[model samples]
Target: MRLKVIIPVVLISLSAGVLAFTKLGLSDDPPGRYEVIMNLVGQMLKEGHYQPKPIDDAFSKEAFNKYLRSLDVEKKFFLKSDIDRLAPLSTHIDDELKGAQLDCFRNINTIIKQRVAEASAIYPAILSQPFDFTKEESVVLDVDKVEFPADSVARYEAWRKMLKYRTLEKLTDLQETRDKSREDSVKNKTDQQLEAEARDKVKKVYDRYFERIKNRQDDNDRFSLYVNAITTTMDPHTDYFPPDEKRQFEEQMAGKFFGIGAGLKEEDGKIKVLSIITGSPSWKEGHLKVNDVIQKVAQGDKEAVDITGYPVEDAVKLIRGNKGTTVKLTVKSVDGTVKVISIVRDEIIQEETFAKSAVINGTHKIGYIYLPEFYSDFNDRNGARCAADVAKEVAKLKAEKVEGIILDLRFNGGGSLPEVVEMAGLFIPEGPVVQVRSRGGDAIVLRDRDKSVQYDGPLAIMVNEYSASASEILAAAMQDYKRAVIIGSQQTFGKGTVQRLFSLDDFYPVKDGQSLGALKLTQQKFYRANGGSTQLKGVSSDIVLPDPYYEVSERKDSDALAWDEIPKSNYEIWSNPVNTDNLKKNSEKRMANSAAFKLLNENLATLKKLEKQESYSLNLATYKAEQKVNTAALKRYDAVNDKVKELNITSMKVDLDKIGSDTTKIARNKDWLKARTKDIYLDEAVNVMNDLIAQTLPKMQRKQQ
Candidate 1:
């Protein structure tokens, strides 16, 4: 388990001298905008949400608890007395929302501001000197499981233990480095020197982190978080996006946005270009490379503004511009070379986000299609559609005459519902794919009117815990029809509800040029053609594989909607349904005998043990011994990626032609092919396709006889 560092508010400053608590403004009068938004939100939730719960005392309390948890999940800031003081507002939120009175929010926000100011003074005092790592005490990593402090003294004590634990970790890391160096040469630094250096490293990390928090957060940001807390209480997917956030959301959904298209991240107080999106201005110019530190930005031909110490978010504002606009970036390459690169911003379409297929050269030629999401262009009817792209991939694979096809939806979190319907129609004959039920309405069966089968060969849908929404719809449809062998996790992410994005401005007219946020409301819930809702209980796989990495499921979310059933739609099952029992038995027998799977199980057991051991000893020797044991256990699973049995993945001719003149595109495609060679999941998926081919071959022979 990774121990999370809790940065006290006093740690907001770099040095001890700057730890001053400022008084917060706590006005009882609510802002007029708050009243307007509150009334709008209340009306929207009642009319727009799929299943609107009454805005009663129970809902208010739930929202109140959720808001506090969102603000401080680790129980770090507020004291027990503070919570008791605000306890009355837990049930009063119901009345407040109805009356457009934000007294609760005002009170809570004011108290948090005061708490943050007070916390700014504790950390600098604590980190002024070295901590005793030899102290025979333990620190809990899962602080959420613990209770809040009773008073200010208790809170300070909690912060002390947290800082000490972090300092100990840094100390251990430095000591290990010093020990490793001692193996080759004589060590110069003593334990005290190493401890001091370790403390400095921890302090710098927290300093940078706090600096960003201070620089980015404002009253409006706090208000946005407060609004989101209320919206998300309805469901995890429901959210309130402010004006700027709404624009970002639209850009994400559009798949193409007007910008320089360089992915940026902050590292060591510098904004570094992580990657350049292919087909973007930065990629075409061929100057900005990954790991290049951006120092300054100039819009058009204006004087360059120094962005050296700017946060990644702030640095992005300088880089992004209107389409066809020129932006100059002064960057420092990894080799210590400084150069100014000019790039004209344009529409950057993420091709990799679309559908792509490859031929897996093995015992059985398998067509592998990896759809990252069910992307669809809502802005243009003729724009990119995942369903159409998938159909194209199927055609490309068919041209190669592959024996089997594997649709990988392992990490696909789903997108357009209509695209999923069309994609599902590609496998089986046209029929009802899924049923959607709106609030206070009957289930409407969404069917594929197209009767033409695209690729009717042996198919296997690869899914995991993250394969959700549209992914689940497709998987559930295929499973219902016995069209494909669903393999991977026990069940997919159980997100069955559909959300409609609504602009807040449309609901209430604002003449003051003030910006109102957008709301993502759950308007409908989808059910399988078999009548079973895929809400809390997602689509289960036929051959459940070991997923030791991510323990994600709908049940983990406390506010998830309950699973239920509607009337089963009248639909015909596939004429030749899959023999799932035989397939499951064979897969299970093979898994029980496989070395890789045995190691995977061992790794899962180790992880489970680590999850249970949340407390860590402050003693250096004890901590090192525990880490050593965990590291040794992890070594067994190191060969998991190396044991990839020949998956000869090759790009299609169309893709090869597209990448012919572009070196970056060629390199990216080559990397994609190389990555597939080491994919353990893909290896198993190919094996599953092989099993399906083998099973179908005997049946074909009998049919001939």
Candidate 2:
């Protein structure tokens, strides 16, 4: 894959009040494993990293601050006094690294252990007391806006407020549920009883939470986190993975996992769903979404288990199971409502994560190919490759005599750089597709040497904010050649840097059963053949469209590499360039007049306004009123999805053989085709192709003939 950005999912489960771990007593000396890894990491950064910063006191301070944040992101554990005590060693970390000592880490680890033990006592005491929800107060949920407590008394007071807020949140939820239903059972319960129940529920969640934190983490995990702090200081994309983390990273990149098929992360001390893998059982079930917090997990016919405090890895173990078994998740939505979702454990092969084609019935037959990622099986020569699969799909479309083609790359976060070059060649006469420049090396153009143009017809490439890396390269190349009209989001995700993974064991051999993990280091930057880099500034779309995801872009990422241009690569422009200026003007006019687009814009505006909110009330009245307003506003946008357009999408005949025997595949394909009819972006892409055929392609084809 070309610069595969690995997002590690950390989920762990705990048994009651205990977490499984091997704790090391604090010592002034660094552990043998840590000493070896740290020294090697420093060497690797200096030699292997493309943009290595000076390993001076400034870098040391950055790493120190980063490590502290990782240890306690929500400012709930360490107090201001603890921070003050640790402050003196901030610049000394550079000296420590150079001398192969870790006095600072040893002291910080000891302090954290004491604080965790103290926190274990503090949470239950606070939760056991009755919470007065009627109190007029607000808790600053934004961690960056708040400071650490001054001392033990102040820390407990902060804990009290946080615990009260949690209880208040649950109390409001319970009261609202009763108000909504007015059921016989719910109506019988007194407000006091309901309030007490909510408090108990919050306590149970925290009880398990504190227990897991006290137990699940080992010295290795802590050491790994410290190493990552150092690595990530180089850049946001660069990361150090512990052995287990490396295994998980490989599993995800392989496009399959024997689990519930949900990506997870620890956010604000809760396990939040990062994403539901496409074709996974959880995705098929459709109850989960990004940002939803998983509060509890239960096996089939077993008592529900609280997992709120569990480490992400431990929680993930509880979620993963033998195929066909059922795991139930109690998921809290983004808006605070909670529900139970059950998904059967299954092997997620990720077959659907590759390229898939369907024929869209329009005035002119149009073939639509959806590439989720530029995937490839590097180990197996005959294994699946996205470019090869796309070529096969195009050949199938050619056999069907399709008049035009649309490549849908929305939310495709890129993979396999070589595969992208091959895929780009399929649409145009082969030439320089992209330029790669490594540190201390000359810029080399990655070319598609073959002169064959496979699908040189009316074409449109659809993208969104999540389209990135290899996605940017392919789109930028096609745009540069004027071979196709790029449509959809304002710009694609601007990740143009390349990364190479190095196994830590390769540098230094470890003892049997011990692992040092892997490091993903940025090694190069990619530029378009026309000389423009798609780094921070992504490939701009020809026909811009309103998208809820417009807020997401590389510009928001503070650590992203800057945009710069290199010398233009030698390449010929397309013989028949597209009329993008005319096409864009027509699309803008249509978007202005279209009702669906209008509603989409309104929805995006509301979403963006909501995104600005940083504080929330602990008072039930104010919270509910605000939530109601947001809910009502969201309901107005439901029409955006309900409004269907003219799209007669059908599965390819070639896919029939693949889906004939598998009912799951058939059902998935059916759902996919149904969703396309309601997709405004796809609707616009099809229209763009129609416009191309009517206004642009005819003249170009005549000239070529």
Clashes of each: 4, 14
Those runs of model 1 whose alpha carbons end farther than 4 Å from true positions after fitting are: 1-31, 182-186, 277-279, 283-292, 295-344, 510-514, 644-646, 700-705
Error of 2 at 669 (Å): 2.7
RMSD of 1: 9.4
TM-score: model 1 vs. ground truth = 0.89
Cα lDDT of model 2 by residue, 1-705, tens digit: 011112232111111111112222324443577766676667666666667788888998999988988888888889999989999888866666554477778888898888878988888888777776666787777788888888889889888888877877788778878888758899677778887898888877777677676656667778878888888778767788886667566555556556788879986568999867767888889999989999988998799778767778888877876679999999999999999999998886777677889999978899999999888765456667889889999999999999888999999988777889989999878789999887777788889988888888888899999999999999999999988889988888898887766676765556665877888777778899999999988989999887778657877866567889999988888887888888888888988898888888888889889877877777777877888889887997887867647588898777898777766567778888888887888988888888888876578768879
TM-score of each: 0.89, 0.82
Candidate 2 CA-lDDT value: 0.80
Q: List candidate 2 stretches off by more than 4 Å.
A: 1-31, 211-215, 256-348, 550-552, 644-646
